[model samples]
Target: MYQYSEFDKQFVRNRAAQYRDQLERNLAGTLSDDEFRPLRLQNGWYLQRYAPMARISVPYGELSSEQLRVLGTIARDYDKPDAALLAEAQEKQTALGTVPVPGTNRQVGSELKYGYGHFTTRTNVQFNWIPLVKSAEVMELLASVNMHGIQTSGNAIRNITADHLAGIAVDEVADPRPFVEIIRQWAALHPEFVFLPRKFKIAVNGAQEDRAALGWYDIGLQLLRNEAGELGFRVQVGGGMGRTPIIGTVVGQFVPWQQILNYIEACVRVYNQYGRRDNIWKARIKILVKSEGQAYIDKVEEEFRQIVELDGAPHTITQAEYDRIAAQFAPPVLQRQPRDAAAQQVHQIIRADAEADPGYDRWLQRNVLPHRNPELRAVVLSFKRLGQHPGDCTADQFDAAAQLAERFSAGEARVTHEQNLLLPWVHQDDLPELWAAARKLGLARPNIGLITDMIACPGGDFCSLANARSLPIAEAITERFQDLDEEWDIGEIDINFSGCINSCGHHHAGHIGILGVDKDGKEWYQITLGGGDGSRAGGPASPGKIVGPSFAKEEVAGVIEALIDTYRQLRQPAANGRLETFIATLRRVGHEPFKAAANAARFVEKEVA
Candidate 1:
C-alpha cells in the first residue's frame, strides 16, 4: 500500500479544512443551494434520493487494513438508518400483492449495521445515507485513513482503476498500479481540465484477461509487451455506454510505457478543447471522436507533439517519479512453503479433505485465482451473498475483512471492478483458514464470475437519477439462482444492471445487461446481449448488442433465466464438462438465439418474476 508522505498529508488536511469551511457556510445559508451544489459535488458529496451521499475514493482499489477498519467505523457511527427506504420499498411490493420472502439481513437497526460503504463498479465507496451537516465530518474521517473524495465527482477525472490482479496475476505483463497512481496525482485538481465537457473515466489492465472493462471507459489502456519485450499500453479511446454505445477505437497501438502519461494528457487536452459543449447528453469525448473520426486522432497527435515540444508540460511524469510510485506498490516478499516429502504427505491430507468436503472444494475452485508467485494464490472474497445486494458488505464484514487481511494475506487488499474484494497476496497454504473466516463474515458465496455475481448500482433505491430500483432486481436474480451447480452450469456469465444510462453498473459491458427505464411511470427493463468487457481470446472488447424489445420490470428475473436456459439449450456441448460461456457462444453463434429465448420468456401476468 502507498504510504502518505508528509506533503501528501498536509495537502489533504488543507483540502479538508477548505471543505469544512464550505460545509459550514452551506449550513449557515451563506451559500445558496446552487452555489453549494458544485462545491459539494467537487468533494464527492451528492444530494441523493432522500439524503446526502458521499463517494469516497479508493484509488486503483487498493487499501490497507487500517484504512478499511476506519471505513467500517464511519459506516457504523455516521450512516443513516437505511431501513426507512427498505420499509418503503417493501410496502410497494405488498401493494403489488407479491409477498417475496424477506431478505435474511434483518439487522437494519443494529449498532454496527452492515457495511463500510456501497462498493461501486468504478472501484469506489459510496455512503448512500449521510447527513448534510456531517459532510465535513465524513471528509475528516476519510482523511484519517489518508483517503479523500478528491476528484471523485464533478466532471473531473474519476478514480483511475487498474487490474485488481496487477502485481499478483499469473499472466500479468506489468503492474499498472504505479502508472495509474501517477495519472491520478497529475489529474487531481488539474486547473486546465477540472471542468471538462463531462465526467471522464480511465482504466488500465495488465493481464490478458480484461477484468477492468477497459473498453467501456473514456480511456482504456492495456499494458502488453512488444516484439522487443518492452512493456507499453495499447490505447483505446472514445468507448462509452449510455443512449449511444460504441467500442473504443484504437488511438495508439502501443504507446511506450514511459510516454503513456504524455499520450493520455494529449488526449485529455484535445477533448477538453474540442469536445462538444452544446448538448449535455452529447458532451462526452466519445461523441466528439465519433463526429470527427480520424480528425480526433490527428488533433491528439498534434497536441502530443506540442506537449512534447513543451517538454511534456507540467503534467509530465518523469522516470524518477514513476520509480518512486512503483516502489510504493512493490510486490511483497513471501517465504515459500517447503515442498519436500513431508510436505507431500501433508498435501495428501488436504487433497483428500478437498475431495470429501464439497462446499470447501467448490469455494476453492470458484474463489481462488492463480498467483504470480508459485507458493501464493490470490483470493476473491465473494461479496455476492444471495439475500444481499451484489457487492454490498455490512460494517461487520468490513471489519472482519480488515482483520482477515492482517491475519492471512498481507495487511492490504484490492477492490475489484466487479464490486468485490480481492485478497491479492494470500498464500496457498492458508486457503482453508481464510475461507472459514470469510464464510463467517458472509463473504464465502463461491460465486465469482458466475451468474449470481451480478454487478448492480444503488439504482432507484438511492440514486435520484435512476428510473427503477436495481437492488431489488439483483436480489431477485440471486434468490432465483440459489443453486450453485446451476449457476456453474450457466458458466462465466456477466449480468449487470444500471438504473439509468449512467452506466454506473457497467451494464453495456456485461454479456447480459439490463437497463431500467421509465415507461409511463412504470419501470421497464431493456436487455442487451453478446456485449462483453473484453474480446474473446485476447481480442478487442466490444459493446453489447440490444436484444429485441424491452420488457416490464416484473419479467426481469424470468427473462434472465430464459437467457440462461437459451444458452443451455442452444450452446455447443461442453468440452470436458466445462460449458462454453455465454459470451463465447454469442461470439460464435450471434445473439439471435438468446433474443428468441428472451421473447419466449416474457411475463404476461402481473406477477413479478
Candidate 2:
C-alpha cells in the first residue's frame, strides 16, 4: 500500500479546506446552488435521490486498516438520515411490494437500509444518506485520514482501478500498483482534463488472467514485456457499457511503460476536442471511437506525435519517478517467527481440519487464492450474503474487517471488482483462524464466484435514474440459492443485475444478465444469455443477447432457474471431469435452448404450495 507523503497529506488538507469554504459560502446564501453544483461534484458530493451521497475513492483498490476504521466511523456516526426522512423513505419502499416466491404467493419486500457503505465495481465506497449540511464536516474528517473524494464524481477521470491481486497474484508480469499510483497522481486535479465531455475510467491488469475486466473500461492497460524484454502496456480504448456496450479496441499494441501517460494524454486530448458534448447519452469517448474507428486512432496518433515533437512530452515517466512510486509498494514482512517447522505443523493441521470439516474444505477451495509468495494467501471476505445487498457493508462489518486486516493481513486490504474485500497479505498458516473469525462476522460464506455472488447496483430504491428496484431482485436470487451444495454444483457464474440501461452493475457482462425495465409504469425484467466479463472464467467481454420480451418481476427468478437447468442439462463433462461451465455450455450449444427455456418459464405458473 502507498503511504501518503507529507506533501500529499498537505495537498489533501488544503483541498478539504477549500471545499469547506465553498460549502460555507453556499450555506450562507452568498453562493447559489447553480454556482455550487460543479464545486460540490468535483469534491464527490452528489445530491442523490433523497439525500447527499458521498463517493470515497479507494485508488487501485488498496486500503489501510486505519482507512477502513475511518470509513466505519463515518458510517456509524454520519450516515444517518433524519427520523422523519427515514420514515418517509421506508414508507415509500414498503409500498413497492415484495419479491414473489415461485410455487407460492409468498412475497419479500425491500427494506430501506442506511448507515452502510456500498462497494462498487470500480472499487469505490459510497454512502447514500449523509446530510448535505454536514458534508463539510465529513470532508474535514476524511482529510484527517488522508482520504477524500476528489475527482470521484464529475465528468473527469474517475478513480483508476487495477486487478485486486495487483502485487500478490502468482501470474502477474509486474506489480502494476506503482504505475497505477503514477497515473492516479498525474490525473488527479489535472486542470486541462478536469471536465471532459463525460466521465472516463481507466483500468490496468498486470496478471495473465483478465481479472480487472480490462475490456469493459474506457482505457484498459495490460502490462507485459516486448520481444526485447522492454516493459510496456497493451492499451485498449473505446470500451464502455450503458446504452451502448462495446469491447475496447487495441489503440496501442505495446506503448512503452514510460510513455503511458503521454499516450493517454494524446487519446484524451483528441476526445476532448472532438467527442460529443451536446448529448449526455452519446458523450463518452467510446462513442467517438466507435463512430470514427481508424480515424479516431489516427487522430490520437497524430496528437501523440505533436505532444512528443511540439510539446516535448512533459508527462513521460522517468525511471527515478517510477522507482519513487514503486518504493512505496514494498511488501510488508510478517512479524511471525521462522516458518520451517511451524509451517509444516500448520500444514498438517490444515489437512486434518479439511478432512474433518467439509465446510472448511469448501471455503478453502472457494475463498482462498494463491499468492505470488507460496507462504501467503489472498483471502476474499464475501459480502454477497442472503440478508445484505450485494457489496454492502454495515458499520460493524467494516470495523470487523479492519480488525481482521490488522491481525492477519499486515493492516492492508484491497476492494475487488467483484465487490468483495481481499486480504492480500494473509499468511498461509492463518487460514483456519481467519475463516473462523470472518464467518462469525458474516463475511465468509465460501461463495466467491458462485451464483449468489452476484453484482448489482443500488437501483430504483436509491438511484433516481433507475427504473426498478435491483435489491429485491438480488435478494430473491440469493434466497433461492441458499443451498451451498446447489450453488457449488452450479459452478462459477456471473449474474450481474442493473436497474436501467446505465449498466452500473455490468449486467451486459454477466453470463446470465438481468436488466430492470419499465413498461406502463410497471417493473419488468429482461433476461439475456451468453454475456461475459472477458476473463478466463467468463470467456470474453461481450454484451448478452436478450431472450425474448420482458417478463414481470415475479418471473425473473423462475427465468434464471430455468436457464440454469438448461445449462445443467446441455452441458457436457470437461477434461477435468467436471461439468462444463454455464459460459462454455452456452457457447457450445448456442442460446436457443436457454432462450427458449427462459421465455417458456414466464407462462409456466407454479401451483400454490
The prediction achieving the highest TM-score against the true structure is: 2
- How well does model 2 score by local distance difference test? 0.87
Which residues of candidate 2, in runs, are more than 4 Å off?
87-113, 337-355, 603-609
What does candidate 1's lDDT look like per residue over 1-609, in tens digits?
677788888888888889999888878999888998998899899887656788988988998999889888887777753566546545654563322212334222233233347888888888866677777987887787788888789887888998888887778778888888888888898888899999999999888888787888899999999999988899999989888888788899988888888899899989999888889899988999899999999999998888888764545667898899899877766555567998678667765665577888888888998888898888988888766787676677779889988877788888888889999888887787677778777788888888888999988766778877787778778888999888877878888899898878878878889898888777889898766777342234666778888888778888888888877877775576766777777778877888888898887534543
Cα lDDT tens digits for candidate 2, 1-609: 897899989999999999999999999999999999999999899886656789998898888898899999899899888776566555655665432211011123324445788899899999888888888888888898899998699988889999899988899999899999999999998988998999999999998899899899889999999999999999999999998889999999999999999999999999999999999999999999999999999999999999988999999999999999999999997898666988779767865765588888888999999998999999999998877888888888889999999989999988988899999999887888788788788888999999999999987756767887788778888888899999999999999999899998999999988898989878888888888887888888899998999988778888888999898899899989999998999999998988888888885544211
RMSD of 2: 3.5
TM-score of each: 0.91, 0.94
The number of clashing residue pairs in each candidate reads 5, 2
